[model samples]
Target: GADVVHAHGLHAAARTALALSGRSVPLVMTWHTRRYAEGARRQILHLLERRAVRAAAVVLAPSSDLVDRARLRGARDARLAPAAAPSPRSSQAPHEGKVRAELGAVERPLLVAVGSLVPHHGFGTLLDAARVWRALDPVPLVVVAGEGRDRSALQQRIRDEELPVRLVGSRDDAGELIAAADLAVLPSRWEGRSLLAQEALRLGVPLVATEVGGVPELVGEAAELVPFGNGEALARAVVRLLGDPERCAWLAEAGREQAAGWPTEDDTIAHVLSVYDELAQPSPHPR
Candidate 1:
């Protein structure tokens, strides 16, 4: 029999709770991200999320924002447990010239945004900002990495509006692409210690991100932040950063310093194992 059951995400927690009904095993749940749905579907998920959090002996979340969310959802014991970024695949240098040439951004300010092309990821907002970037001295090239259901709609809009943006679908070398760009943009509506942000910072690339969820806490003063869904603000921030070489250099150094403070994979494992050990201890008062 299992001593403790650990579940990740809302659906997994719900399923685990149902399976462990009337059992004595303690449930530990890790809340990752909020499910973005609308109307009845959103309501159903809210109820399920509440039930799952309430059932868990302890809930773990990657950021303080998520920990607060879990507590508000009825989790009795919620704690911050940030997930570590995966180590780089190889030490090989990023092909900056090759990536710039392929994207047709050889003489332009190359901007990169990487994530699933979904509504909540805010690709639409980035496209709107791209429209603003069009009036710059040398039009910037915006390339997005990743594919999703919104690809068709986004592509259609890009073609019709003639926005200087390209949806590059999915790429295995997203990190390399990020490193090659002049600026990395994260226009997410919400995020929890974003992996793209981590990777960008770790690579010493300057970043412009939406100030939502755990982003402010994660990047601190290292990256420029704009309000979520504000295309104009995002565009302005990007323009300001690009025009100031000194500021950009400072931000690059700051980004590297910030990333160095994040928890390592081994640290994450040790923290998780400690939680398990604490919960697995025998009861002091036997009934």
Candidate 2:
């Protein structure tokens, strides 16, 4: 009775219905991420992934890397359909004043990072960079705007090391915080085309982020890149950007231009609909 089955990942919940529903339906799977595993568990997952790829009518990946991986896993039709960020027009609200005031209205350089307090987010590296940033004559404020289980641990490190960093916990107005900053940073150890990076670029905020996952592809020449987990590199990138206002301005302008060319949510939906129209056609042979 179903026209098609749309799945979002290689996980059980995403693929189970397509694999076991015992019905003939066009299946579309969107590959968002892949997890690390080992031993028999890894083999099991690999096998399941192969089966899922074989069963899917089409696989949509957010980046070329994911599309390549899907094809390697035996997906019949894998295509690139990069994820879209919120339109810049909608995010133009000016809450920057309120956001800066909440952070003691700091007059010095302000760096913003927006992600949960997770280890893989590489926030510990940011803390180390903050220490380096603080040794300067006018210390900068590093504001992280997200919450997670590692909150206590990060807070403890800040207190013990006397680092110039503050965790603002979860924030609904994260775009405002990014807008209030002199720069944005994403020290992720791994990522799948970070939404934060997209948002930062779209908002015309210069960024210093780790060169991991699809970040290089996402930012193009619009931002500075640093190696993952290298606090020294992260700090140096920040210093370079902060010292050069002209370069920062160029990056901000370039980021906005690049982000403008990126596909929007409506584009993604239209692409999906196009695929559906193709797959929904009746075959020459009747079932």
Candidate 3:
């Protein structure tokens, strides 16, 4: 009954007690993007974004680059309010052997990714990577999780590529695969936050992600970052990591270290409380 709103993400909106209509109140908006265009309009969207932030009580962004971008857009006072990273301990990472058996992965090196099967996620690029991996003596099996409107198109692509990929469909057990897989990949066009990538890192798993959005800010050295939408680069990273267990182990440990900073539910709650407190503080009369 007594609280102020703290908004997060592109669709979030916060309503605070501060008023301009002294009745309309001020908003605290959290911008979660850095290097992506906003609308279909071929115009000054970035500048428009700053004007929107200027109307807010406080401008909070998940990454420093986002803050800088917001400033560049012309927000006089934008700050970083990073998202809470989830802890690996609470993650339901399943036993690799059990999951492998369940998924019939004993015969192949499983290269898997779990996310919305859309153009932005680069399902096509993943297919290309699989093609490269298959050129080797023993090919890797690609299993994809997630369901989207583009399923039919992607299936056609698989047929065209003649790749050994099985669409596992929307899954509730991605944690099992994340633990079982020989490789975890996130080939995306954009990501203000990659919770999928975070899950892999939490399980002390290695990742092959493209350099995009706020992912680099989150993963640090935990992942092998390649250029966006580059099939060759994606395949190279996947093959290199899959071929070398010693390097994979190093990457796994590095992921664990980076994942150590992941914020849990507790952190989210505390941050909300802090924002409410900040909003509730009475404003001093201007001289």
Candidate 4:
């Protein structure tokens, strides 16, 4: 008999609660992100989310926004447990030049955006912004590294508009790609402690991200933040940061400083283990 069951994501927690129907085992849920479903699917998810939050003995969230969300969904106890991004692989540093040349960003500025090619990820907004960069000398090359159902449509727009953007599909060397760029863009409509943001800052690469969800809390003043879904603001921020070499340098250093304040992998493990220990204890008055 398990003493505790830990489930991650809304769906997993809901299903786990259903599976544990008549059991006494305590359940711990971790809310990662909200499902971007719509209409009937959205309503169904809302019901499931409520059930999951209410059923969990404790809900762990990676960001403050998510903690609030869980509480709103009826979680009795929710705690902030920031997820740590894995440190960049040291070997990737040596191949930076090679990556830039391969991506055809050797002479021009390289902007890297890593996320699924989906609507909520806001890659479309990024492409719209890239259109503005066409007039610049040595136009920046925007390379998105991920794959999803929205790939075909995004690719079509890139070609139709003659945008300097390329869908590189999914790559295992995302860290390498990010490290090799002049700037890293995170145009997502929402995020909870974005791994790309963490990696970019850690590598001393300047970043421009949307001010949504936990991003502001995560990056603070370390990176340039613009309103979500605003292509002009996004483009302006990127251009301004690129032109101001001094600020970009300052931001790079500030990014590392900010990243230093985030929870480390060991810290995350210790915190989670403590939660497990607390939950495993027998109640003073057994039910």
RMSD of each: 1.0, 2.5, 3.3, 1.2
Candidate 1 ranges beyond 4 A from true positions: none
Off-target runs (Cα >4 Å) in candidate 3 are 1-3, 11-24, 33-51, 87-95
Question: What lDDT tens digits, residue by residue, belong to model 4 across residues 1-287?
Answer: 88889999887888899999998888999888866788999888889889999999999987788899889988999999868878657562657889999999989999999998889999989988998999888899999999999999999999899999989999998988998999999999889989899999988999999999899999999999999999999999999987899999999999999988888889989988999999999999986
User: Candidate 1 clashing pairs?
Assistant: none
Model 1, 54-90: lDDT tens per residue? 9999999988988988899889999999688779777
TM-score of each: 0.98, 0.89, 0.85, 0.97
lDDT of 3 by residue, 76-172 (tens): 6677665776544566556787887777778778877988877788888888878887787577888898999878988998888788888889987
- Candidate 4 residues lying further than 4 Å off, grouped into runs, are 90-92
Each candidate structure's count of clashing pairs: 0, 0, 3, 0
Top of the candidates by TM-score:
1
Q: Which stretches of candidate 2 lie over 4 Å from their true place?
A: 12-14, 17-21, 37-48, 88-95, 284-287
- Among all windows of ten consecutive residues in candidate 2, which has the lowest summed lDDT? 12-21
Winner on lDDT between 2 and 3 is 2
lDDT of 2 at 208: 96
